[model samples]
Target: MTPKQRRLARRLRQLRVNSGTSLEAAANHLGCKQPKITKIEVCQLGARPDEVRMLCELYGAGRATVESMVTLARTAKTRGWYQVYDESANPENIDFVELETDAVAVSNFEIDLIPGLLQTEDYARAVFKAGLPDISADIIDQRVELRIARRQRVLDGDLSVWAVVTEAALIRAVGGRDVHLAQLTRLLEVATLPNVQFQIIPTRAGEYMAMGVPFWCFRFDDNYGTVALDHLSGTTFLEEEGDVERYRLAFQHLCSTALSKQDSLALLRKYIKEEHSEWERRS
Candidate 1:
């Protein structure tokens, strides 16, 4: 099922239960069979906007809630924005992008690289080149374009972002010193946005919780959350309550151990200068 459909399905089911309604009753109200209602709630069948509105009304949802669910139901039937990059994008990455579209906020922890949503075009291109050397340049270009589009949401203030990175990641010259410095400068600029927050874990911090793991927690206003763990193989999304909670807690701990927002920006400036100086010296 699509992300929006899944979200709508889950919320519809919850609303039914909260209203003390049974599947049989819901089906009867819709003049359908129980299996049909079950399929709608399971996302095996799409829910029409009228159906969603009716269901929400039956579930005692307010006018606003009904309209919201109805809108989601309508959008769930449309194509996702990332469909254009299907040929070049990883399946896992596409899935993450789909889910990210509906996310109200994102909290990401990076162990050795800048978070994807905060990366500059050059930095992201360098990363794709280094990580996926087997792919063609055309494919890499497509991926880079996709990354830039994803990054735009953060810039447009459509999505709030909280990012935590290790000092090592900031120090590593991913795309050479010039690209690294540019990336750092971009980070400082992005950090100034009210919707974006950045924290850095200094190398001196030593050991901490989830020491070697990196993950992203996406929170939605619908009371659902997802944690994405990116690996060499693919990205794994955890939606179960326990798994999401664990990652959420881990991110909180990481934030607490990392430098404050102001300090992080200060450290980022320091690195930009150091990288620029090193580049000039070698030149």
Candidate 2:
């Protein structure tokens, strides 16, 4: 299912539960089996606009809410632009790209590397090559190209981004000195964007909150949100209210522990100067 379908499915489930309606009752109202309702709620089946309106009405939703959901139902089946890269992406990564594309705002915390949306081509290529050693070079190139396209779509849209990276990321010098320098330059450029909030957790912070993993929380219209955790095995998306809330709190704490946006930019500048000076001396 597309991200829109996922959100709509979730919203429908919430509405039903809040109204004290059973799946059997919902199925009866729609003149379908309980499994159909289950499938709709789980995003295995797309809810038609009429069905969405009917369900909303049954759930005692306000007229405005009904209209809003019906509209989402109408558009939920549309394919995202990222589907073009389906051949190169795994199912989880494809879902992530869909969510990222649809999100109005994004909060990202990276532990040891630059956020993909803020990474340069050389930097992203290096990351893919390092992480997927067994994958064919062609696949790696496709992933890198997809990353660049994803970045452009998000930045070019009205998306608001708050990204926090560890100081380690800036100092690691990925893809050697030249690529690292260019990546930092790209980050500085992105940081200056009005819609982007960039911060860094200094190494001096010494074992801070969210020390173990990196995650992204996506905020969408209608106040729905989703959290994504990427691990070695695959990407996991969390939509449960409790899980989303926990990640949100963790992200908030991370932001508090990070350097302010202004200081983060200054830190980037400091690193860039050091890299340039080292390059000059070597040359």
lDDT of 1 by residue, 196-246 (tens): 999999999999998888899998866568888888999888876678889
lDDT of 2 by residue, 1-283 (tens): 6777889999999999999999999999999999999999988888899999999999999888888899888878776777888889898888898888778899999988999988999999999999999999998999999999888855785788899999998988889878999999989999899889999999999887788789999987666789999999999899987899898999999989999999999999999999899878988
Q: List the lowest-lDDT window of 10 residues for candidate 1.
A: 1-10
Candidate 2 off by > 4 Å: 1-3, 20-39, 60-68, 281-283
Model 1: residues >4 Å from true position, as ranges? 221-223, 279-283
Q: Looking at model 2, which ten-residue stretch has the lowest summed lDDT?
A: 150-159
lDDT of model 1, residue 23: 97
Score residue 56 of candidate 2 by CA lDDT: 96
Residue pair clashes in candidate 2: none
lDDT agreement of model 2 with the native? 0.89
